[model samples]
Target: MRAPRPRAILAVLGVLLLTACGTAGATDGAERATEERVVRVAAAADLKFALEEVADLVAEEHPDVRLDLTYGSSGTFVQQITNGAPFDLYLSADRGYAEQLVDAGLAAPEDLFSYAVGRLVLWTPDGSALDPAPGLTVLAPEDAGTVAIANPEHAPYGRAAVAALRAAGLEEQVRPRLVLGENVAQAAEFVRSGNAQAGVVALSLVLADPLRGHGRWVEVPVDSYPRLDQGGVVLSGAADLGAARAVREVLLGAGGTEVLERYGFSLPGS
Candidate 1:
């Protein structure tokens, strides 16, 4: 075969280089475009419904970003995170637990902040079940068979329940009748499920549709316990730190704040 002219060989090489560059660029763009980020969020059980609402709202705007939420007592969630549960964010029902994560260096302390102040409520489905007039006074020590409370050892709501009972002068009376739950949501379930005649639960849970349809409740006096300052933090090992940050903004944003309020949660400023 005759050797190709220098100009012909140079032109062919140039064409090959251009084609390779185009293909590489397309591949790079495809890889970048195909990458979708997911953020795992660990939330308190009391926030199950509220967080679900916010998740739905965020999903409308961020199709590529997803929220993977796990709900439980704050203590349990914190323990999970410390054990490397791969959560990107943590929302605790109490500021103390969130601070514990910050102190343990499991979370980014700078990102730690309180979102809401939880309220405990005394709820009952039957208005006339034991009342002179439907109130906390009726579930007195002599009257309660089973009064549900979150586990005070781990659940912030449980701690509040203890405090509320103590303040109302019903602790001793209700003590023997107390039935513990793992978290505030479950505490509400005890009362709603009729496992316990009445219970102390987070106001948010009692206000949820299922509970609302099932009963009526009184907001436990704020004077009873230290404020249930619910807080959140961004985890250090999150894959999409930016997305996590976006989620924080949305949660603290007006829309999220509004949802929290309607669910009986008190906001930071309020």
Candidate 2:
């Protein structure tokens, strides 16, 4: 065509720009829809290893969903959730904390369910002279200077540790040499780092590889401590309730149970 007017050329360019913008908008929307759907999970430190395996299973099944796990003492998570933390799910080492969340209106009471039963173990780093035993008597040796345990005030594992010690009549003796950790994982870390001679930690932790080989452990008597009936709740403020529920279901299902059992956890109500 004969040379188009400058105005006509400018108009054509504007139309092209508008078309490009529309295409970009549609692409952006599609990308947003496909972006990984993240579900924040606040889990007890004891679930560190097992939960990770469960998360991997979840990822394999639901490629669109991503689990973001935050591990800590269940009591700490309860406080955070009660104070309005943005978590999609809360997996507590103790069922009491989950019930507390339900009672406080932070979670649906019906959504609370027991997932696993945790067991405590006396863990000593590999090559340590200390012998693993059912009771705290192993720590009586002068060389076993200090014992690490989670904080009893806020950690379920810590409370269990204290209970076990009390039942074994060693609470009085061990109390003076106790080095407290913020959570069970940290308590294990204390022993691993040689800051303590031994630690009372979750059996799940000691069963996982790397850690399993890193230390020697003995199961504490079940009667020595109260049952660790672990439970989980979907938070009332969940960003994706469906996804949260799906993850919970996966954990309660066969595949998840297999992973939990592999990590030394017992299924609840089993």
Candidate 3:
């Protein structure tokens, strides 16, 4: 084989350079794809079930984005967010909390939007003699034992339970017997674990797979308490603002609404 001519040698070198550049580009692209894109969300306890489904929707829609969800009372989360907890999104069981964040400048008003209206329920695990179908009246009996509710101090569902009890004229009688949980999910757990005879919990919890069909529950009359009016907001310090906004969209989108509805959440305006 002979040495290549000058023009031919230059052409070969150009092709080699192009190939190397293409390989480098492909490697960079692959590296970019492998880097995990995450969005951290602080959500209300009542969303324990429905939000997980919404997360599935997020996964299907944005394969590169991963959601890290933490569930608790909206009030507790409000305090956490206020104290500078690093979260990309905040989903509150009460829209008022989201509004509170907007007012405080922790989240933008434009980034805040209502998602769903939650419902409260009277729940009793399987084999309980208590008939919750009669509504809040079941708690009237002296033998009603300990009734669990989320702590009204910070939990919206707990506040709603208080309101419902008052509306049913049972506040005075049931107040002394109430067992308060840190959040609504814990309230349900109190009943499920047999620590409490009955509970006033988020309807979505009873409808979730883990508890569904394993117990019985009756809707606490919507009129009996203030509407839940759940909401979500993209935080101002979101690590990935774009991903946070995408999450907000997924929760309010048709697919997310469908999941919320299936889990017994009422949509806003519809």
**Predicted model with the maximum TM-score:** 2
Alpha-carbon local distance difference test for all models: 0.84, 0.90, 0.92
Off by over 4 Å in 3: 1-29
**Roughly what TM-score does model 3 have, to 2 decimal places?**
0.89
| Tens-digit lDDT track of model 2 for 70-132 | 999899888888888889999999999999988988888789999899999998887788888
**Candidate 1 off by > 4 Å:** 1-35, 126-128, 132-134
TM-score for each model: 0.86, 0.95, 0.89
**lDDT string, candidate 1, 1-270, tens digits:** 999999999999999999999999999999888776788998999998989889977777676778988888999888888888888989999888888888998777788988998988888755527432345677884655688899998899999889887887888888889989998888878887788888878888877777776666777779888888899998878888989988888889888898899999998866
Cα deviation of 120, candidate 2, in Å? 0.8
**Candidate 3 residue-wise lDDT, 1-270, digit = tens:** 988799998999999999999999999999997886799999999888888888899999989889999999899999999999999999999989999999999988899999999999999988788989999999998898889999999999999999999999999999999999999999999999999999999989999989999778999999999988998899999999998999889888899989999999889985
Clashing pairs for predicted structure model 2, backbone only: none
Q: What's the TM for model 1?
A: 0.86
Q: CA RMSD for every model?
A: 4.4, 1.6, 4.0
Per-prediction tally of clashes: 1, 0, 0
